[model samples]
Target: MIAKFLRDPFGLEDAFPPLKKWQLWLAALELEPPIFKTDVLSTVNDMAGMSGKDKETVRIMIEDAQEYSREDSRIDLLAAAMGIPPNQMDDLWKWAAQIEPI
Candidate 1:
């Protein structure tokens, strides 16, 4: 199931690209506490070309995660919602952490 989702995310026309848009949003959310708000707004602003619905979805996901008490639970819920495995979500989060401001 995980592999299948990784190969092709539902509603997306093609295979999940290595540089998924959600990855960028995830990265912004993971920024250091002091810079999180600025980083997220900056990142979202940089992705101004995305659809309004997509932007809303990303924002909601970030907010939901923020409400969680533990990062693991947040990641687990995110993985399930995104149809990816928890391990894959972990990898994506790590990847997000390494991303530099664009």
Candidate 2:
């Protein structure tokens, strides 16, 4: 799922409309923090983009989700939410992590 999203972020929107734009951001942030941070920086440089409120809302959500958690716990939660089997989560995350930022 993370691989699919990375390959075509907006393309899969029709399949998961229930996931808000911010939720997508959270997923990217958790799955690949470095790339996600770079993407956010790019977004910031765009003339027409996320407002302060929009950025703050997603930032808060990401912070709340990660509060008092270790990396393993965070990965476990994300994997569970995506219904990925525990044994396969690491490989899946590794694959997603390798994807070049768009």
Best by TM-score: 1
**Candidate 1: where are CA atoms >4 Å away?**
1-61, 64-72
Model 2 Cα lDDT, one tens digit per residue, 1-102: 898789888874333122233444444556533236444434433525557775555445444543322243534544444445666554544444344435
Q: Please identify model 2 stretches exceeding 4 Å from their true place.
A: 1-70
The best candidate in terms of lDDT: 1
Model 1 RMSD, rounded to 1 decimal: 12.9
The predictions' CA RMSDs to the true structure, in order, are 12.9, 14.6
**Candidate 1 pairs with clashing backbones:** none
Q: Candidate 1, overall lDDT?
A: 0.50
Score every model by TM-score.
0.35, 0.32
User: Model 2, 100: alpha-carbon shift in Å?
Assistant: 0.6
Q: What is the lDDT, from 0 to 100, of the residue 49 in candidate 1?
A: 70
Q: Give the clashing pairs for model 2.
A: none
